[model samples]
Target: MDPKTLLQNFINGLSLGSLYALIAIGYTMVYGILRLINFAHGDIFMMAVYFALFFVTLAQLPWYLAAILAVACAALLGFTVDRIAYKPIRNAPRISALITAIGVSFFLESLAVVVFSGIPRSFRTIFPQSLNEMIIIGGEMEVKYGREVIVGGIRFPVISLITLIVAAIALVFLWWFIFKTKVGMAMRAVSLDIQTTSLMGVNVDRVIGMTFALGSALAGIGGILWAIRYPQVWPYMGFIPGMKAFVAAVFGGIGSVPGAVLGGLILGITEVMMVGIMPGAAGYRDAFAFFILIIVLSIKPSGLLGRPEIVKV
Candidate 1:
């Protein structure tokens, strides 16, 4: 492949990987604290897309405002889900909680179908149109793949740059939130030992709720960006991406934020490279995550960044 084609694919992988990373972070956070998969997370992401769709299309709000509102609503919904669905079963058996999570996931998907209908909806985003525009500068930028982008001899899409920047910013903020703030400390404490943290006067329930909210908010961000990139919305839209993000979380080391990001980028690049290198295998794109999952589990169940569990009988 030519350098321009390689660069384009590279950017595509980064963009997709960034989304996976964002969504995977949510999965890791919830599992880290509660040890629950929270299968409904993807559906929550689906809801965020609808939320943004309505905020922009029906409510006639600007895209940026819609995004903020969508994230806020997602956070609220996540908090509510934790309070109503998961909270009651907190002390129950782990299997019970897992079943509840699956049920919640189904409920969200069903609710979306009923409310939004099964048909896909399309919408526009506020992303700069100039992103797709070609600009010529010194050295006569190289363009390939018909609509390929080039600036200062570097071949990459504008959307790719935006996605990378957004991912970086989100990770940095999350790092600060997890390591610096008191709430962050409480979250870590709860994750380490909930009973002890509760005894120490930390509101365990509150911390859990905040974790759900934070994760859901990040999911919301991922959802909004996804809609902007793909410009389509449907009830089942989150299923595949959700699974991919889960794979990323596991691949990177569940419960580790940085790991989620790493896994996401790796998964994204691998998938993109696979398709780019073997276009005939594009039909198998969805299978890539499961394949990676199986390999990762077989080699290191703890994942690349995750610490192995120690059990005492």
Candidate 2:
């Protein structure tokens, strides 16, 4: 491939990886605290975009306002899902919670189909048309993607730049929240030992709910950015991407935030580069993630950044 195409594909890979990192971070956070896989997470990602669709299309709200509402709705949905589905069984066998997560996933997907229908919805009106314009490096001049753009160090799609910047900002906020704030400390305490933390008078259930909310909010950002990049939404659209994000989380280390980001970048870059190199195998691109998962599990089950669990007798 030519230098320009290679550069463009690398940038696309980073954009795609950024989305995966955003979503995968949610998976890691929840698992860090609850040890529950929360299979409905991808469905939650789907629901968030649908929420945006209604707010933007039906409510006729501005895109920025709609995005805010969508993220808030997603956080609310995350809290509600825990209370309604996962909370009651919080102390149940791990397998029961696992099955319930799967059930919840199915429920959300069906509800979306019934409410939003199976047809795909386009969001051409939502994203600013300027996002399609390219920003050439070494200068502030911008031009449309197909134009004779030059005088460059690198060319970046505005949407890709936005996605990368947003993901970085959101993740940084999350890190600060997890480390610096009292509530974040409470979250970490709970992750360490729920019973001990509760013994100290912390509201355990509330913290768990908040953890879910935080993770889901990140997924909301991811979903919105995803809709921006893909510009279309459907009931079951999140399954593959969600699963890919999950693989990213696992491949990086399910309980490690940085691991998820690393795994996502590696996976995304590899997938895009592979497609660029051999267009024929594009059909099997999805298989790459699972293959990595299998390799990781067989070779290093604890993952790159993960610590092996220790059971107390």
Candidate 3:
């Protein structure tokens, strides 16, 4: 492959991987503390895109404000899902929580179809042209669909570049919140020992709720960027990406943050590189991620960065 095409493919991979990483972090965070995979997480990502679309088209709000509100709404939805769905099952068998998570995911998808209809919504028809300027390329181009950027004389879609930038900012802030804040400390404590942390005077439920909200916010940002890059919103849109992100979380080490990021990047880059190098096999792109996961798990069941679970006798 030529350097230009290879570089473009690499950027595409990074952009795609960043989206997975953002969503994967949410999965890992919930799993880290509760040891339950919140299967509804991808639906939360879907709702975020619809929320942004609604705010921008119906409310006629500016894209930036709409994005902020959409993220906030997504966070609230995540918190509510935890309280109403997962909280009641906290002490139940882990299987019950897992079943409930799947149920919640289905409910959200059905609700989206009922409300938003089965048709795909296009940003070009509904949103102002400013969405591309502010959200995609930032005044670099005026095209309605996709725009390219020339860096060192190689042209690549600006959406890929900007998506990476946005994901980086969001992830960096998340790292700071997780590592440097009081709530973060409480979160870590709870993750280690929920019962002990509760006994130590921390609000266990509150901390868990905050964790959900924070993780959902990342998904919202990722979802919005995803809609812009792909330029469509539909009920099932988040399903594959969400599943891919989950695979990324497991690949990186289910409960580790840095590992999620690494896994997502690797997944995205490899997926895109495959399509770029062998165009005929592009149809199998989605399956490639799981194939890689199978290989990784064969080598290290605990994942690339995950620690083995210890059982207390």
Report lDDT per candidate.
0.87, 0.87, 0.88
lDDT of 3 by residue, 8-121 (tens): 889999999999999999999998899989999999999999999989888988877898999999999999999999889889998999999999999999999999997998
Q: Which run of 10 residues does model 1 get worst, by summed lDDT?
A: 140-149
Model 3: residues >4 Å from true position, as ranges? 124-146, 310-313
For all candidates, the clash counts are 0, 0, 0
CA displacement after TM-score superposition, residue 157 of candidate 3 (Å): 1.1
Clashes in candidate 3: how many?
Answer: 0
Q: Judged by lDDT, which candidate is best?
A: 3
Look at candidate 3 and give me any clashing residue pairs.
Answer: none
| Pairs that collide, model 1 | none
| Clash-forming residue pairs, model 2 | none
Over 4 Å off, model 1: 128-149, 152-155, 310-313
> What is candidate 1's TM-score against the reference?
0.93
Please give the lDDT score at residue 151 for candidate 2.
42
Q: Any idea what lDDT model 1 has?
A: 0.87
Off-target runs (Cα >4 Å) in candidate 2 are: 132-154, 310-313
Per-prediction TM-score to the true structure, in the order listed: 0.93, 0.93, 0.92
